[model samples]
Target: MPNDKNNKTELPRNPELTPPCGPVKGQYRKGISSYKGIPYAMPPLRERRFKAPEPMPPWEYLRDCLKPGHTALQMGGILVDSPGTYQMEGKSEDCLFLNVWTPATNPEERYPVYVFIHGGAFATGSGTEMMYDGTRMAQEGVVVVTINYRLGALGFLATHGLYEEAGTTGNYGLLDQIQALRWVQENIEAFGGDPEQVTLGGESAGAFSVTGLMLSPLAKGLFHQAIVESGSIFSIASFAPHNRGDLEKSMTNGQLLCETFGTRDTTEDLYKLRRIPGDVLAAVSMVKSDQSVTPKAFCFWPVYDGVVLPKDPVKALAQAEINPVKLLLGYNTNESSLFIKGHTNLGIYKMLCIEIFGPEKATAVMEHFPVDDDHTPLERMLEIYTHSAFVVGMVMMAKKYASLGEDVFFYNFDYDPAILKIVGLNTAHAMELPFIFGNGIGQHRATKISNLSWIMQSSWVNFIKTGNPNFKEEYKGQVLWPKFDPEKKDIMVFDTHLSNKALPYQEDLAFLEKIMFGNEESV
Candidate 1:
């Protein structure tokens, strides 16, 4: 990992700039000022475990905000430096830092700010993922902020011991995000950002966290707009430890985890869980996050603790109880293919439905996921998981927000190149990230691919700048994206030609809804 401890290394200095909180120096370029690893909260270790985040202690001396600090202790996933990808391991509990990319440092030029949360199934991922680079977005005239929050059991393990001590139970991770937003409101102006007009967004697990935040009363005034890419509690609930939250089950899981390490006493185990080395706890939590299905899949995720999240996220959004922020959400066409790496049979498919949708609805669910003669068994399996996990839930939320008269923009990303389709990840989960951030500047080898990415990138930043994603002038040959209407359900389909179409795959989604009863499993 890089030395991101606010080290006072001899580098090009931009003079000491003092803010309301502290004095920190950052590297300034011709048009932008960059700051990395700025602590927004004290590390969540030792006595701080399972508690709400505390403000970063103020410093008197000049602190160097240069490199990104340690990532919150996490098991490797697609977002981390993993074995299949890179080899860097950034795991630490002292990971409550936020990185800033700004166009100006002057307080007068208040720019629209976009704060991004990363996704890793709620157990992994770091904001420093190469694909989440904010330079291009900042250059497009919006201040960009990326944050890190605690993951795994450290973030979501709710228990009676915790409820008695802290009025709140689990959701320390969500609190970490709220605290970071508070820090932004307090300090972003010093870094050339308008805290008042912040837009919150993320992909997959980050998007799921965004869902939780939008529905959280504590996060009410912190953000003005939201952009959720490919996550929905209505769909993700299947992975939760319990659908409605069973304290007995939670206690049992905790007890077993303790017993695995030869600790039988519940009190002793709870204390040990808090006192053990950060990495050791993270390693244990990583192992537990997965179920019998796979090693990387997560079974432990966010829960509706009634305090942190008032109701199940699906119900909260459905009833218009969530924060009335400007909403933009969408899903990919082949989202499930990202998870379905191998072939499977009808028996396995039926078995998964029984586990996910329950036996009462499993047989009925198969009607929605029919195996057409033209499609392969693997394609059928991908469709079942994809539409169930992403498409239907996302569409339902957009309709809910639109019905409540909230400003909503919805889309369907099917802009898959031949290469992506050949690799079997055509418009798969998180595939739109590069296009949205325009992080593909150097990797592009073809004009068509470059042009598509440019349009997607401009649309995203434009939305951040004004809450409207339509950018026809700068990115020529791009179609206009209209506001989503529940009656018409005008969906923006992003392909070679960006066009508007009525909501697609409605019949299939309706069937899923009939059997699933609206996120019965998005745990």
Candidate 2:
């Protein structure tokens, strides 16, 4: 087994079919564990572009997974260079890799598996980031699987002619996720996991991916439980103005862009794009620093293909047409504020006006969220923006899930780290990840505020073990987390200490409900 820079000895050598290539050790758990990066499908380079994932050929030798496998090409050519972020060293067309974390000696323990999908708006990110390390969760008696799939234009471009030639397009990334779940269903039992107890969990775009899976008929029964963090149902209006027609036009526009880059002879020219450098392909994304480029204003995402997605997730979740799965969902307190750091309050008023009344209806929007004498446009902008994105919309989703008679658990994570509090980004989006994963340990500034890692992780583990997360009887540190109810609207507010409440932002939530499920003007 290989050793890290710290001189700690790793696990034993790979035995060809075992999960651990060497004994796995981490900050949380000490055990023999193998980290395997098994490829479940063929690469999507060259002629495989815009097609569904194909199964990979079996290999006889042991795959060296002491470290993470290759990551998919990050959209916009932006490398995943963030500290504490998951990353991969290599890139490839055949990058359908899945990483496994299991307890070292449990070849027969039958642990519950937690399959995670990383989020970067479906454009950036890999399962390789250190924050997503499964060793800690595996030490807690669960196997963790994180995977890499196509992103950006490579994953989400949709074309009618392309679909006519290829069976599918615009959703190859999602299909890859589906195929990974299928692979787990067929093979996770060999890795000491109860495939039937699989829980699909993710954040941001990953959370959206979970919803997409819930809506797809192909994904039914592949998973039983879901944990959606931060991201709620994406309404078509929020994402785009038109439906499939807009997506088709976008794809054709992308083809035209490729043509401008001297590859428009035929569809074969599209496959030739693989030979291009990473930076060149990245240049095609629409999210520029200046944000002036046209073509695809927003790049990468699963478009609504009638056969696969059938309809938008918001419509599906509202109608109860989504696949039945027990759900645990939550959002942060100040999500949108993190992005617009220095904006004035007046800017907030302008944004609300634009969203509610549109550019033409800005006058009406100004009436609702007005600017104060002391606040700037950006300051007001931050408040309304955060509320619109994180607080209000997510509450609507929780309410919908609870109304359907499903066992839904909801939370409002208001624990802001000291650094965030300094910048006024209190409990912004994705801030709760470290706490849930126990990464909040050892930090004197943040850790002193609260220690919810054990509670949060254990709660998740208990949920995987049993459909409900009420582990009060089995675990001592656990708190009483009741299922959500429409009438009482009980919720868990995570702060310096956890507390139960009727509704954190009851009035604002009612406004969101009127927009999402009631007959009222759009927000």
Candidate 3:
């Protein structure tokens, strides 16, 4: 609304907005007003640990929302420099906070809202990451929100004890996310955002969370649109054998974790486990592994508890029992590049392949990606993972949605900026974040990176605004992004020279889909 000529009047330097919970004061900066560190749920501590989030109590006084709040207790440096370096301070179990950015805080104005979930393999990362700052995106006349949910063991640990206590278990982090969206639906109007026009999005684990939320009955009408970048329902299958709906494995792992603390899976032991320090719980749940290879062991993740996620993702998609939302989803060319590194010999590659796909299917799958003089075994393994973990599942989901007559847009991000190419990260996983957020592009003005950033930001904002990326007139003739056709499978390729074309690696994707989904018709 700040962009509208009729509403161009100067706003107060310090803005105050009253929502259902309380009155919060936010600061104005360069025409954009932001509220940071607003708690959407009560702190999950002591007896509340590992339980479903409860709504924060209403406050009578104006709360200071100037600085970012504590991130969910997590090991630092999972995606950055070192432990405690990314988020130096303010890491606590009491981290159910969210941040908002808006062009104006006038309750009369109704702008589209985008609530993004940060991803760090469901363990690390926070809403306040520098790359996730919403100021630039807020300039596009949209309200932007980012949030921090519980992570690692503090967020997801399923056991019989937890099941007895909460009637379900293992998705406390996801419950935190759902609570945040509820807060948006209840309070976004005060921040000049339309609760009915909310778009939920995320990357990596966050993307997984978005897809999980789509299948979750509890999260069903909270959002109407979704933007999933570089992750999907099948992404977690690479690490763990059970589907997201399966709780047996997660419960077994939870018991094992409790055993590590010299405790049992009884209700009494649950209290003892909760009494452990947050940092100690985070540290004990940490698993050290080589970044080059896909981890074979199980880690804490969302489970099909028949409550939050009522059905297995594959079954849910097959039954079409998901929240039907306009979807804009895609993946980068080399999604596995960030996770896989170092030289992979043929023996190691074969072993990894056998580990992922069974020995019976490994040889057949290996035939599709042969190591050659130009394509080393490492490159072949990376390609195998990129398709198995990211591409196949994403295409399956997109095709499923398109088949159901949902407005679906798909993309392939192939833009490899020279700076990243030099380091062998050519359009790797999460490389598109800075561009989508309109950050980290000032230094690359001389190249097409800035222009590509503009294209992405414009398309993303248009999608958030109208549920159609091509709704804007400027994209009418020059860049016509077409809707994904289930039969044709057209995808918008994001690069220096953008084009709409059929998805690449079709044969490979089909093969992987068969291996992953078998004879399952619905995917």
Candidate 4:
């Protein structure tokens, strides 16, 4: 017989694990209600493959939003029980679904909405990834919505005659994002969220999408705040062109892809290209995305299309016409290490550099990069690549936006688990996601990071609640977070103990800037 003192009540069911059986899409998990696999637009198929997203017809029945909808046909990077081994099972062309998590179902209650776009280089990735489950944010008294948009060749392949026929061509994925936002504008209120207070955010290519939405005239009035994580102008040619040319770069890549698929770069052939199965196109896109950075850049990223993207975002930021919204932007410390392959010897490193940059220029660059016992030649070059991809652009964009009288907050994600560091991926790209999303790191999961994760997610929730990330009243203690203005240059470092740090990496930044922008005479 159980004693009264030792008796324990059975725990209630996890709300997230329980999906509503009714037509209204929702599941109960953790104390939050989630609506999964809710379609935001009609599925892109057949002739609709490369065209703009058409409006989703209203379903008469209560659509069961129980399970996660299909992910777009993309390269597999799903984090299964282990970190890898993502099989393509449910991915399909009918992948324009979104998941919503909210604390309340009552329409009278209005919570701030956070819309997250997933990152996979604008090619692969779905909102269904467990890392982005909105239950955590929803539990914190905010609405968190994750979306799945189109990707790769089907989403970004541009054609001239198709443009003439459809009146809008590529960046259909971007348009899908816009439609999702539009759906939120129309329906989030019913989910107990305020459409007026929406924050658009993403990591990697998702972050690129956020920036694109920030500058897009179509997205002008849609979102009130923006968050960019590890996205910058120098990430790749597709995200940002090295030059200001419009369709030339994207068109060339599109042509190559067309040729590879046995379709010509002609108006009539575009019809044939559209007929290519979604799975086939997605497979080809995955192969193309693996191409080396040199030779021809073939990423299917959004071009500076006149319709979707009014102007080059980098150029637009330079002109100071970017929509004035409260912005929270950041990058990890060892971003380039995500792509760096470890080398056993310095000769191989030098040879690879010479191959990439050519002999003379490689020699000059090699001489500039220092190598020591602790910092290997490979590590030093990875630092340079890190500075090139994340740091330089973060500084430039932060300074530019802050100087323009818009509110900006900056941080550097430096917290990494020993397990990840053991594998040579310390504070690598998108490594901050688990901490940010309240999911602990793999194998290294413990209570040690709980406090730090709490602080970060709390600040994010507060930022969603209000433009400022500071929530002294909720903290039960005073916490000061300063803005990242040109004058102050203040940055918050997320690590063991939160502390403010002055901007670092000046010398490497100067050298890289000179290499990128300086002429021999100018120097």
- What are the models' TM-scores? 0.89, 0.83, 0.94, 0.86
Q: Estimate the TM-score for candidate 2.
A: 0.83
Off by over 4 Å in 3: 1-7, 76-78, 81-88, 241-245, 287-290, 293-298, 372-374, 443-447, 475-477, 519-523
Error of 1 at 479 (Å): 1.4
Question: How far is 94's C-alpha from truth in model 1 (Å)?
Answer: 1.0
Q: Write down the lDDT of every candidate, Cα atoms only.
A: 0.73, 0.64, 0.83, 0.72
Lowest lDDT sum, 10 consecutive residues, model 2, at 286-295
Cα TM-score of candidate 4: 0.86
Question: Would you give me the overall lDDT of model 3?
Answer: 0.83
Error of 1 at 440 (Å): 2.6
The Cα error of candidate 4 at residue 207, in Å, is 0.9
lDDT of 1 by residue, 343-457 (tens): 5666667666776777778777776567678765577777777777777767777777787888789988888778877877777888888878878653353576666776777
Ranking by TM-score: 3, 1, 4, 2
Worst 10 residues of 3 by lDDT: 287-296
- TM-score for candidate 3, please give it: 0.94
Error of 2 at 319 (Å): 2.7
How well is each residue in 1-523 modelled by candidate 4, as lDDT tens digits? 1112223222223232222222465566665778888888888887778877887866667676778899988764422223232346788988899988887644467789999999876777889888998887777788899999998777887666566566656688999999999988988877778889999989888887887777788888899998888876334432334222246666666777778878887778877887777777776656222111332344577767777877766667667756678889888998766655575257755654554444666676677885777778777767766676567666667777788887889998888879878988788888888777886442223455777777778888878888888766654323477899685578888886677877777666666555543422110
Off by over 4 Å in 4: 1-23, 78-87, 163-168, 238-246, 287-297, 344-375, 441-446, 474-479, 510-523
Which ranges in model 1 have alpha carbons more than 4 Å from their true place? 1-16, 79-88, 241-252, 262-269, 287-298, 372-375, 442-446, 472-475, 518-523
Better of 2 and 4 by TM-score: 4
